[model samples]
Target: MDNIFGDAAERLFAQTCTPDVIRRAEQGQPSGDAWRACEEAGFADALVLEDHGGAGLGLADALPVVVAAGRHLCPYPIAHTLLARAWLSRVQRPQASGAIALAPQGLAIDDGRVAGTNVAWARSADYVLAGIGGQTWLLPMQAARIEPNGVHGSLDGGVSWALADAERIDHVAPLETLAASAYTGLIAGAMDRVLAMTLDYANQRTQFGKPIGRFQAVQQQISEMAEQVWAARMAAQLAFQGEDGLPRPLLAALGKARASQAVPRVADIAHAVHGAIGVTAEHDLQLYTRRLREWRLAAGSESHWHDRIGADALASRSDALTYLRTALYGKETA
Candidate 1:
């Protein structure tokens, strides 16, 4: 789908998210400039209501911007901020500024405050949205004592907020499913880039005096990689399917499960096809591959969603087959 939001975001990132920018971000550089560009372009506020001074686009419309960010390996929390703004507006809370790192599943509130470890982008984010389901707390990073873990090669870290300063908003929209859908979209876009890069390399890199694309073994790996790539693409489309711009929970779970499952194999095949050169710091392959690995674990792994699906099926009144049909096709079984 050709959308002004997606098209503009693609163009914006293409110019700002160059190899040098990715390298600098991976090296722990601040992503202020790129983030400023996004903020100025009004991408984060894409989903907020027009009455709230936003474009009031739906999740389906705004997701392309997130996918574009993933395709470009955007260093900041663009998707997180988009979801946050949307949620804040849903509960009639004041529209927030600055990058908001969303912690959808991890951490909990106690005594009106939240403390959590393994918060992605905690070191760099201005605020963290901590909650489960419809209730969420927005805590400023300035009030917290941030302990940077530096894990996953990004801004992942541990943070403890001054709970008294927390802004708690109840009856907010559930974010886990929203996050899952967007994460799957990111996986789809990143895998597309990786597959394209691998294909180009296979046709160019020579082995035994011939291009590796001509070899049966290398061709087999590329074929497998292509299968997963398209599967992820299809899964993302399914995940984003919903009514009135809202994603169905079952669809989100299935999409995230399938997309997350594709990550390890896709990253492995891309590296395997390129041999040692793919992992070199100077090469661009590792940049995307590492983020692919990280995104797999974000929000929840495949196993987490798989178990959720299985449990739901078992708990449903209908048979397994009917449940599956209802989940995938939205048709109720008699």
Candidate 2:
């Protein structure tokens, strides 16, 4: 499919998410300018309905922006904001301006009170969308007591209120699928950047008066990295190509699993190729690598998704090939 929006988003992110901008944001500085630029460009609301003051794009269309943000390590809650806006629009809730975070775990609503701990990005968000007892809610940030849990590289780490009073709204969309799709895109983008950086370094850096890439050992490593990157990107693409309005959980699980599994290997090879410089904060490689490591655990880990996939396959009594085909193509062959 021709993704014009994806193309546009990629260009916009490339223009604004420069190395200097990323470096500044990584140093605990606010990325207001970057966020404002994305907001002005309509990226922040890309997944919301047009009736709700957004671009009215599908999750597939909006996912490229998430990928681009990942590649640049854009210091914003790109995926969370997209999901929050979509959920709010679906439930006819008034859309709020500024960043929003999604609490995927540790949320409870009782007697008009909300309680959660370790809600991602709650400290910086204007609002939070959480699920409690199979019901969805939109809670204002002020209603919750947020404490900074310190930074984990590019990720916004924080703990939320243990208990707070707030009104709950009804929303039931397959948010986990959306989150998995977006996170898969992020991993794909990070992998892309890391692979590119490694390739460029391998071709340029000389050892023993020859380009390191010319060595068999280095070439083998680069080839493995390239394969992992391709697999992760393709898996993410498959996840984005949902059958209906929602992403296929099986595909999303597989994509997230594959991407998460690829992170450690990709990071190892990328850093190994770049030597000690890749780990330093001064180098751009660490930015993408660190985020890759974190994104691997976010939404769900490889083991989590693997267990889900395995359970589903066993429950359905499908063979390995059948299950793999169904997960990748969303259908069974006669």
Q: Which candidate is the best by lDDT?
A: 1
For model 2, state the Cα shift of residue 331 in Å: 4.7
What does candidate 1's lDDT look like per residue over 1-334, in tens digits?
3488899999999999888987887667877898899899999898888998989887778778877888888888887788778767877899778988878867666666577877867766788887743577788988887776656566677777766878877666667787788789889888988999999999999989999999999999999999999899888878877754467888989999999999999999999999999989889999899888888988899999999888887778677777878856577665
TM-score, predicted candidate 1 vs. hidden true structure: 0.92
| Candidate 2 TM-score, true structure as reference | 0.88
- For each candidate in turn, the TM-score is 0.92, 0.88
Per-residue lDDT over 1-334 for candidate 2, one digit per residue giving the tens place of the 0 to 100 score: 2277777777877887787877766565667777788788888888777887888777677767877777876667776787667767777888888887776667765554566645665545667766667876667776666555465544344444434444467656565666777788889988988999999999999999999999999999999999999999887877776632356788888889999999999999999999998888778898888778878887788998889888888887877897777744667666
Off by over 4 Å in 1: 109-113, 132-135, 150-152, 327-334
Give the whole-model CA lDDT for all candidates, comma-separated: 0.83, 0.76
Model 2, CA-based lDDT: 0.76
Question: Which candidate ranks first by TM-score, i.e. highest?
Answer: 1
